[model samples]
Target chain A: MDVTLAREWMRAAAGAIAADADLLTRLDAAIGDGDHGVNLNRGFTAVVAALEKTPPETVADVLIKAGTTLMSRVGGASGPIYGSALRAAGKALPPAAEVQPADLVAALHAGLEAVRKLGGAAPGDKTMVDAYGPAADAFEQAVAGGADLAGAAGAAARAAAAGAEATVPLQARKGRASYLGERSIGHQDPGATSTALIFQALADVS
Target chain B: MKKFINDPADVVAQSLAGLAAAHPELRVDTEEQYIVRADAPRAGKVGLVSGGGSGHEPLHGGFVGPGMLDAAVPGEVFTSPVPDQILAATKAVDGGAGVVHVVKNYTGDVMNFQLAAELAADEGISVETVLVDDDVAVEDSTWTAGRRGTGATLLVEKIAGARAEEGGKLAEVAAIGREVNAASGSFAYALTSGTTPAAGRPGFELPADEIEAGVGIHGEPGRRREKLRPAKELVRSALDAILDAKTFTGPVLLLVNGLGGTPLIELYLIYGEASAYLEERGVAIARQLVGNYVTSLDMAGMSLTLCQATDEMIRLWDAPVRTPGLRWGA
Candidate 1:
């Protein structure tokens, strides 16, 4: 995948988040401040607008711009987490016009690491890290197994979706939902769900 | 749904515009959604800045004045303000003495303010932060992501603002803020949930015969829902919880804060009940304030805050303050 595909992935992710905005918010309302969907939607919409207004020529440039836009537009813990994720991923990539499937794997790993570091949440914390962490691992494994870029993306998406669904039984250990203690167990994490949606978008666009 | 708003999205901006029009003493930056004292950047004095989401009226914004916050950064309802806005406000209000950030201990607010502090330090501005976590409700809550900062935020802001106004150093003001927070405890109960403009619905629906006890300002689930009782019973329960958390023996400042939508008459009634309960417990209520100060958005409820007042705190609390929501001997 190249810079153009990266843009398409972002666009597809934006569309997916927009389509499921209310659902995400409803999930948040169950155990959060009830604005996750609104915040993410606003940030991604601004990112889309920014991308259209000043289209980046390189993969690194596209991702760096997207990260900064998310940092500014999305207010809350998720903003910094996702912003750092994208920025770390972008920084991991060399300034090249195109990126290989292996580069994508490295970028996902960096992004997941950034998210975990910034959010102070690990895989079982019932945060976006839960989904994105597994997705990164799955993508790297698929790439190592010599799967093509699209095949690896599909694998990552499936892993992320399953990871998100798997959050239902785990008690929240981080973020606002953690405040609920055991009560937060039944609800799927909104951030994890959104993460799954983002990977699904990447697969669809690929 | 019947709110007198042009659009849900515009509620905060429009309300800020109205505040600007009504109070010339305060300067409102509509674009950034921050309010600063007209005479800000008071040289040789510690600058105080505090803010949170917009729905809580007379809180960070309403408390901005001579004896309180120098600037207030407001975000969307129930959301923490972003780093840029906070960084801007910190810079705008900074004097040579440095700035004190009065932050509630919610995850978003803490993270964003910490980010701003880092940015400010890079620019050579010394910053001190005081995190308020005084609510005796749940140890953690949906909005807080930790022990929720409830009514004591106002008390801390006011006391710290007074210290800042008195030419206290950044460390001194921040220390006083922390002292206030540590010395205070709060509890709230809601008859109904607050309605966010965007949601167009109440945060939660409590039955008319039931009350949400030990609730936070943002309508997070409290200890439990129980059958509604008389004002005295509710006040007793709230006071008992607060006393259990932090036992106060001497003179204490009592704040009966009306979460918006509660009538002044009811607040007075609640205050009377709360004060009477304190009297029965042999705790002296030294200073008191009753009104819609720190509030949830149109949530029918009230919170009780008790701060163990020092002689210095009382003197500072009595100091002049001029703002839209609070005013005295100006």
Candidate 2:
């Protein structure tokens, strides 16, 4: 919820996508085409590049610019979904003010909604929504349970990781993997795993 | 691996640049994401546009020449080009008569292209579309995600382009597109994994001794994986899968497409196997195409497409076509 902490999460998200490219690619090979890791890496790399080129004046501006950069550069469903998420999160924020726990919850809720809308996918779709939805809920619930910003992000990251791991048992209902039917089972969703990493990276950042 | 690319991110962009440089006969809008013939629309002829993902070279790009497609849109590797890109290409190729879209029936491709059609209509462009779902890999896959739409795309583009260039209306061109969709079926097998530039690795893991049957063009493995079989048996299996339902079908157009990485000799070997099987079944191969009309990155495999053509269909198939990937017209 802290503005400093939330911005750090974005940076860490970029770093996380970069760091685990091979693992993500391996995950993708099992289910979808083995390009998610690299596709997202390139996209987030562009986001980092844009951020470096023009440091935003406000926290919200930072999120919006990063989101737009990813959308413009990322090629697949991940592009629009992640892009809209960041943009929505950015819009939910006050112009140049610090963010509180409630503010962070509100922003992430908007981001999750944007991702759901753009992807036309929902929970149990064996998509990033699986990780993101549970993560957001866990974060809010943890905060309600009297956790602080980092504490909430940590809970969110754990929930996201568990949700991503759980996708191995469920059949995919979205993306190219869905066409594989029962074969899509037993393979961890590359998108959901990468999403879990985003939250994990946020926890690491804190 | 032998490809001349700096990074996966720059492969498509760099390839587009090289394509533009090599072919001055086409006007390339890299930013808008289209390749249009230099003299497009040709005053009264209906426009033809077809595109899908990249990696399948000489497809949309190489096919953008006279007597073929008026415009070709290129998407990122294995991903369908978005609506804005297709719309931009559509407007650029419209000949005042009308425009016909030849779309492969992947859910994403269909959705995006249809959205583009709607966008074009809002801009006052009359666009007719044909959805090709010719791959017999799965039935009602994903509750009518439809067939995978592989292999037969080449036939559709060529035949429909000829009909359009010969003053056929948009509806007629679209009709030919639908006819191919109805009459054609394709089945592919993969002996090796394909490499996507960004991943810097094969798209899937196949055991050294395994072959994947019913694999799609996008390296999505296949319906079943079994021990690798002999070239002849492979062809027999592929043919049986395609021709099992047809009962002495009418005139058929045959295409033996190599799935990249497969040499001409192997393709011919598979063709020999497929041709002999057709001969035994008393199915006349009215027109036969061999070699790679479609490919899956670097996957070592081949798909066979059979289009049971009527007299009208045969006429369209024999029509002249001039494109980098397929050129018969002078």
Candidate 3:
């Protein structure tokens, strides 16, 4: 993706987060402290403002800048987790202004790895990793199959949505939701849901 | 929901402004959202820092002063401080000696503090972290995040702070904090859920005759919900949970802490019941603190923390501490 496409992806993600903030909050209320939606909304809004104030030169720089802004402003677990993911992804990308679909796939894998490292959450742990891991894998597979950016992004978005939905029946084993044990079941994980929204934003922009 | 606040979003900032206005000994950075001792970075002395969500007031912030934490980083209400803020606090409090971070064991708090410590290390500041996970309510196993750090956090901060003030090195301070956390256990029951400023409603609802046992400081649901019992019975249950988790042979330090909305009168009543039960169980209460030292905002509940006190710990506990939330023998 180019820098312009990267900026559009971030803008779309912010818009999606703002629109679905209440839904995310309600999902979190079931098992967590109920601030995921609001926290993400605040962070992404700042990301939009920051990008507008000083637009980055490369796609990697745009992602890194957005990540740093979220890290500073989000004030919760999501900020650091999502921010670290984006930063790691940006760092993984080529320094060139534009990147191939395969490069984006590798960057997505790096982002997913960052999330797993920061949270210590496995795929089945009912965290953002659940959605992110599947999305990254799907994107990589799509790119390997000679798919274009739009086709690969669409595949990743669909995988993320399915992965998020899969969290509804599983018990949480990490984060605040883990405090509920069995009660954490039967509710969609807010982090996974938000991750799905972010991946969908990528697809939308692509 | 009915809190005395100008706006829900501004609650943390406004309260910090008020704290800065009231406590001249504290240097509150409203923008950075950290509070430090006025004369921080005491050369040749280990710097002690502790922090978490803003709702738990008097915790890291109120305990920042002489013989306590050198700095406290506050995040948004019921949220962990960002890494940049934590790194700033760590750097600000780093005397020539190293700095010790006393972190509560929530996933968010631990991750943020760990990130900050790495940042500090990159900047050439020596840093150590002691995690507090003493609550007996959550099951301590691989399946979960482990028992949450609750009332015992106050004990860790106080005893560790005392050691740091006495010129103990960073390792020693962190070791002492870890020891306090290991030797302590806590249990809490909530009469009502806390209302975060952003939410503007109780996090959860409890039937009038029921209570949330093993409730977390952030209003996270506990082990189970049961019908409310008499003060004596409730205290007995809480004590049973803690005492069962760990063995305390010698005299202990008892902290009967009120969760923000609780009154002193009710807390004292809980204390009376707790002490009598402990006395019956032949557990001596050598030192005691009864007040809202650590709290969940507007949560009507109480948590009991008991530290198996050794001579050194007792001596440190008795040391002079001058701060807004706690002041004695200054």
- The candidate maximizing DockQ is 3
**Chain B of candidate 2 versus the native chain B: what TM-score?**
0.96
Decreasing TM-score order of the candidates: 3, 1, 2
Taking the tens digit of each residue's C-alpha lDDT, what string does model 3 give over B169-199?
Answer: 8899999999999999999999998888777
User: Where is model 2 more than 4 Å wrong at Cα?
Assistant: A1-8, A51-67, A84-122, A143-149, A202-206, B1-8, B30-33, B41-46, B82-84, B96-99, B107-129, B143-146, B205-208, B244-248
* Model 3 docking category: medium
RMSD of each: 2.0, 3.4, 1.2
Model 1: per-residue Cα lDDT over B105-162, one tens digit each: 7777887888899999999999999999998876644322567788989888888888
Residue-level error in angstroms, candidate 1, position B30: 1.5
Clashing pairs in 2: none
DockQ values of all predictions: 0.47, 0.29, 0.71
Better of 1 and 2 by DockQ: 1
Q: What value does the lDDT take at residue A187 in candidate 2?
A: 87
| Residue B180, candidate 2: C-alpha displacement in angstroms | 1.9
Docking class of 2: acceptable
Interface Cα RMSD for all candidates? 3.1, 2.8, 1.2
Q: Per-residue CA lDDT of candidate 2, range B128-179, in tens? A: 9988878877655443355777888888888888888888888888898888
Please give the ranking of all candidate structures by DockQ, highest first, separated by commas.
3, 1, 2
> Model-by-model lDDT, in order?
0.86, 0.81, 0.91
User: Over 4 Å off in model 1, which ranges?
Assistant: B140-144
- Candidate 2 lDDT over residue span A62-178, tens digit each: 789888776656655666667779899899988874667777788889999988766667788789999999999999998899998789989999999999998889877777777
| Candidate closer to the true structure by lDDT (higher is better), 1 or 3 | 3
